[model samples]
Target: MIRIVLADDQAVVRDGLSMLLGAADDLDVVATASDGSAAVDAVVRWTPDVALVDLRMPGLDGAQVTAEVGRQAPDVRVLILTTYADDDAVLPALRAGAAGYLTKDTTGEALCSAIRTVAAGGSVLDAAVQQRLVALVGPPVPAPEPDIPDGLTTREVDTLRLVAQGLSNQQVATRLVVSEATVKTHVNHLISKLAVDGRPALVAWAWRHGVVH
Candidate 1:
């Protein structure tokens, strides 16, 4: 089962999430916290596989809790479950080590899938969140020369560009007229060539290097 800790200041939200996630046969709501500090404490105490954290709380915010978890329990993946998908809210949590993010409007099944994905060392950004992120990140400031990574094939660069635009592998495949497996292979290659962690990191690199602008 995927062990989880839920942190949200609103009691109703906490309870609703608890019931919703608990109903999933493969998920266990191991603990719940009402504030950021408590969320960190619960994560440290329970060492759950995933922590569902809110963006705003009294003692510590989502970004703070994510940072604390990264420091105190690096193995525990954090998934930001928040109402806000604004760039200001999403970027910090992600930079602070959150593995995935989802708006509260996410369907119950999709939320569970996100939790499982995070626990399995994958990252997810809600479609809305992804769009907000790109808009917020904005077009990169033009440099004298684009800092393209060396040794990347043209196809890999094309894949990277699509990924930077927040397209999923399937979408990228369709756009490129390639198989999904081919897109995945190109993504893996780009990740290695860029020396980044995952899709998020790859997107960050693309933004920094003006690859997507």
Candidate 2:
């Protein structure tokens, strides 16, 4: 079974998620937290496969909890399940090493699938969240932008575009009609070539360089 820790400030939200996720045969709702600190504590104690966390919690907030979990329990994956889908909220958590981001409006099946995906070391972003990411990245600039970074081939550029759009490696592979390993290779190469830390940083670089308007 896939172990999970659900964290939300609302008691009702936690209860609802517990009930919903608990009913799944392959999932176990190991524990629940009403705040970010407690969420990190639970993760450290339980070392669950995934921690479904909220963005707006007292004490630490989602990004703080994500970073803490990364420090204390690096093997555990964090998947943001929150009401906020804006870039301000999403980007920080992603930079903190969150495996995925999803809004509260996602269906139960999608949420479970996302948790499983994260457990399997895959990233996820809700369609609404992806749209907001693209729309809120930055103000549009004029065309004929700066030159592309050196050593990024055409395929790598395509992969980077999809990554900035919040697509997972598997999704990018499907979109490019290539293998997932190939997509990961492109991502790693771009991260090295662009000098960014991770996917969130890559997205920020894309905006700054006019790669994604």
Native-to-model Cα distance after best TM-score fit, residue 148 in candidate 1, in Å: 5.3
lDDT of 1 by residue, 67-122 (tens): 99999999999999888777486787887988888998899999998888778765
lDDT for 126 in candidate 1 is 85
**Pairs clashing within candidate 2:** none
Q: Which stretches of candidate 2 lie above 4 Å from their native place?
A: 131-137, 144-147, 207-213
RMSD of each: 4.1, 2.6
lDDT (Cα atoms) of all candidates against the true structure: 0.86, 0.85
Q: Backbone clashes in each candidate structure, one number apiece? A: 0, 0
After TM-score superposition, what is the CA distance of residue 136 in candidate 2 from its true location, in Å? 6.2
